[model samples]
Target: MEYTLDMAVLAILIAFCVNIVLCPVFIPFLTKIKFGQNIREDGPNSHLKKAGTPTMGGIIIIISFIISSFFFLQDNFEAKLVVFSTLGFGLIGFLDDYIKVVQKRNLGLRAYQKIILQFAVSIAMIYFIVQYGDYEKMHIPFTDKMLDLGGLYIPFLLFIIIGTANAVNLTDGLDGLASGVTALVSTFFIFVSWAVGSGTLPVAGAATGSLLGFLLFNAHPAKVFMGDTGSLALGGFVVSMAIILKLPLFLPIIGLIYVVEVLSVIIQVGYFKATKGKRFFRMAPIHHHFELKGMEETRIVTLFYVITAILCLVGYLGTAGIF
Candidate 1:
């Protein structure tokens, strides 16, 4: 079955429509259920105003993707794999969000617990890919060379999934930061998936469309926060797509902002420990540093969006052999 651009556009439109229509209904329901966000006391003062916003709004995007995917994707192995993996990772995020919402605490899953769960889920996903698919060969973007990892593919796959999932989580410090960036990354993934002639492109396209729709409600002064639910799930979904397409290396290019966000935290922590509280930035995650430096939140987010868009174009060009 040949995938066409028209189908992709249609899928995106459906997802966008679904999300815009559903967000209003879901946001109010979440607030009614007392699932409001808990702001960190140490966070930027501007975030205090967002404290009571509805949380777990990722449920809206998840539901919209599932419904839209079912309607838009054709019956194919790759499509099924993408859909199932997305929901499976989303379930893990949902569990974490549930704990936070029920306990009314900012702390959800402990670090060790989250890591263990991520490992378990990532391993399962890799095993499924290896057993049911032919992805033993890895491809490097902008080149036709392939690296056959054979038995070592497991470890490599683990790194891609875990790294991407955490990078996105780290980038979620600011309002709409993760959602907007994720939508951009997913849009690139759709292009790459199509260029690679993969049957899963339609599903990726639909996911991108769904995210764009979600972003309308998820941007600054957001009516709802995606929390761990959206960030982790989106990270997992995009990473899995790259893995299935054998293009994991392109993630660093497509998700450059997320990488910067994660690296800022890592550097800050390392420096603080080495110097007994010395710091590289006013705050970690880089975004907060800009806020501390007196940059408006809206400006910082928009700048990041522009950077994300540029990187996404570079990724597509690299994948298309135009770079």
Candidate 2:
């Protein structure tokens, strides 16, 4: 499994093309199945018009990634781990989407149920990473040193995997928001992974391409929503790449959008409880707050993209040991 730069770019291009092809076919099929999105009643009023749009388009992304990265799959632990984590989380998301669309449950999986499944996958991944991962040293940003967490590695990894997965899930509220942000993050990962000679480059490249292709229909006035299916799978893919590349520490920098999106919810909830029903932002997840404040959805999304790109640049510099 010798990798070349051409192969990496090819993987991305193949995934992008495959996704472009699949979306047309899959979106129609999803619509035929009546797998439409159930917009939150409490969400922005503008989203009500998207009610019947096909959801669960993440299947397209997963299929494209698997197909594009297939030729680059190595017969080794890293490759297997990446695939396993992605599919495992994707399965969880698929089930959630199924319950929502088919069963007509607005809340697909119970919070407990979702957490249980996520924990199961996270624990399994952490176990395999400990036993088979090539390195136990986590990189410390802006320095030439690596830190060994030693005994705390398992819990730390669990926190990262689950937190990242859910953070991405939270960021999926708006059309193309999650997919767009993730594409940029995945692009960052591709370069970082390649720099480290990691086996995860193909997967990262495929992710970037698939997300971009998905954006064709996922952007403003989305023809289809990715639902939980795509969001959780993307979270899994992102965290796994970071873990394998020993760049989990760089996630808060590179994935600043995910971190802030999650934190906004946390802060809003805590503030509301403490203030006895007083609100913090106009909405949680911050993006919604901007929308509530009269910013256009496209504008907010672009702002996030710009911030994420800058943060990714910072991460790249840190990874290159440029302080």
Highest lDDT among the candidates is held by which one? 2
The digit string of per-residue lDDT tens for model 1 on 179-202 reads: 888888887877766666777777
lDDT of each residue in 111-175, candidate 2, tens digit only: 99999999999999988988877667888998989989888888889899999999998999888
Candidate 2 — which residues are off by over 4 angstroms? none
Give stretches of model 1 more than 4 Å off: 72-74, 321-323
Q: What does candidate 1 score on TM?
A: 0.95
lDDT of each: 0.82, 0.89
Among the numbered candidates, top TM-score falls to 2
**What is the Cα-based lDDT of residue 46 in candidate 1?**
89
